[model samples]
Target chain A: MVESLVKEYTGKLPVKLLGELKDKLTAQKINKTRAKKIFETTLQEYLDAQVAPGEAVGIIAAESIGEPGTQMTLNTFHFAGVSEMNVTTGLPRIIEVFDGRKNIATPMMDVYLKAPYNKGKDIRKLALLIKQSTLQDIIKEVNTDLMNGKIEVEILSAKLDDHGLAQAQLKKILEKGLKGVNVKIDGSLITLAPSSKESNLNDLYKLKEKLKKIHMSGLKGVTHVLPVKRDEEFVIMTAGSKLKEVLELEFVDETRTVSNDIYEIAENLGIEAARTAVMNEVFKVINAQGLTIDERHIVLVADMMCVTGGIKGITRYGIVSEKASVLARASFETPIKHLISAALTGEEDYLNSVVENVMINQPIPTGTGMPKLSTK
Target chain B: MPKVDPTKHILVPKHSKLSEAEQKKLFDKHNINFNDLPIILASDPAITHLKLVKGDVVKIDRDSPTAGKSEYFRGVQ
Candidate 1:
């Protein structure tokens, strides 16, 4: 009977832990019936730790995250290894997460590589490949010739060799990026002459500046890549995030690689990935400040954001605006707008949720209020 | 067009519409109005594959870490 019980829970419990429990029981000379009873009691205790029905999980989650949020100092810090990259952290980052901002202030990604690439070797080459370089990066100087109505751009030969870029490639990119300009490349010097039709000195100067920012090579949005060693694995940290393009790379580990931008993840992967990103990002900020909040609370917040099949912020214009009850919407920010709009639409407030019920001075439909006393 | 499988998604719970008899039995057993129950939109992906229309009942089977496997019923709105 003991052997049968162990077989029953083989996959459910860790094999080593189960074996230890069985050995402990056998050493005590406990009978089969008693062992089975003990096992059932343990299982019941584990199950009972789960949340009860009608629990106000949303309010609890809000408090759990909000309390820690107040303790965080409002500060934006530069990325450790990369001096040019600055990321918004602490309270502001928390706000950004809850608000579900589409374009994050500092869009960044922690890109993990697959297999041999994740090891220390060949990370520098990979970082250079991922870091987006523009025309300005390889150019020594840009000079505008007002009298000639042309722009002279000096290509740094050393810089070009360092980045492994050819002059022909730059000329091709320039022609494609700027429509009404003739590109002429001679050795290490490139000149751009504006078309006669659009040849105001101001426009030529503007063209020179625009040409300096043209995309030359690497991922489109990525600005900088800093290779950092974490947990004995080499990972590239990019300044500007392009999660879709980054994931498409052959060497990138799709499962482990993630971006701090939540909406980008939703667009690239799906709502599920966005939900996980939200939870992980919140946890990272909270944990960095040496605070411990229950993981379940964070999970609840993520679930609320993703329940509608899309990521929605807990803001007046987002999830709050989409509430079914007019009263509920009015309780949130910009109450006049919501109430006036609802009045115009002749919308009805069913008062099903807590906010609407509380607004009307009624018992909220949760906990003891959930049960109705009917004599029928 | 190939149907997108909703079950393969991690966040989307397995869902199926309750039959008329089963829904009736549930309402009678709980002694509650349909609207009183929790709501899931008609456009929700979990029930989209089921082709559930408005006012239909969907049984959501969620495999929760804490609760093991739990079932929830929602009225499609």
Candidate 2:
């Protein structure tokens, strides 16, 4: 039993400690390479301390790095290389809600195809290449130009194909970079035109050939070509770019989604701004959901949410205290694990026994089990 | 009589280990007049269980079957 438990604990030690150590190193601005070295050395020291230790240091090192309580977001992010590629209406604005910021716009191609063109397509790979080649490159180019004090050119929509006109207004946008650009790639029909910039047609054709030279498939010396379908023309086109190179840009407004109970509480209390009032709203919502929260936790949340400007997911900054970050990580797995780990370290045999006993549905002593009627 | 203190000590009937003479001797040695002490159980199960009480002077035995050894716990009764 002891061996198995130790094995289990030791197995989790490396990975868990790695994450904690990484976070600590990130906060300290220790480079990734140095951080990895420290992690290995520290882990070795921890195992060594148990057997033959001149200086027992693992616990101290662990404690220093193992901050327990931090809130983390389950939210994934979208980065369009060009800032303004709209997937849907107000999609760019919605990205801001989830903390996105790269707003520099350029020609972005959003590929949509009819029926047969959809299967066996790795659109993500294509998106990545185009985004890497265009939007990110453009920023570097522009920034370099600005630093060198050179005038910037208005590099707009690249090219559009013929069958893409099937999209009507979307096709027109692709052609001219109107409200937005659209891109459609169908078989055997490559038409390149811009409604607004017919004069830039020569430039568009040259760029199209450059784009075709990109080997999207793993065919040696074979450049990308429009596939021809019998009686159906292949089409590929261009539009306004919406790729964001960086994740979470600056000064995007964040919205706090309050529960209806909180709204009701605020509406009734009419104290929208006070910190205490905010806590009350939070607790009211929590209670409405039939969950109990400790007053200390409430106070902590209030201080973080109201006073600290911690709007849900944006505060990926600052050093989180050891206790809080651990709790935060543990909470994601199991709050009970957090409770046990907080109450007792791995060294506490009695605590481990009690926890294990409780897990197995065995009879364990509590308040009323204090040797009632005396032991025999 | 230097304005004699009126406090008194009484012995509970259950703990009768201390004889009247022993009690008086203890009182005198401690400069505690009989009136200054409170009632205490003599030889009560609690006295033995915790091995303590007011004016306790007792010898307790500590024997462990696992270690197969014996030790002594001595205290004032």
Q: How many times do residue backbones clash in model 1?
A: 0
Clashing pairs in 1: none
Instruction: Indicate the TM-score of model 2.
Output: 0.17
Task: List candidate 1 segments past 4 Å from native.
Answer: A1-3, A6-31, A120-122, A143-151, A161-164, A195-204, A374-376, B1-77
Per-residue CA lDDT of candidate 1, range A41-146, in tens?
Answer: 7667655865677888788888988888778988888888677778898889888998888888999989999899999767877787778888888888888888
Question: Compared with the true structure, what per-residue lDDT tens digits does model 1 show for residues B18-59?
Answer: 999999998998998787666666665445567777888878
TM-score of each: 0.77, 0.17
Q: On residues B6-38, what C-alpha lDDT tens digit does candidate 2 reach at each position? A: 111010012223555766676677687643443
Tens-digit lDDT track for model 2 on A10-102? 543444454455557657876545655665677677677443422323333333322221122223222233233322312222223222122
Per-candidate DockQ vs. reference = 0.12, 0.01
Model 1 docking grade: incorrect
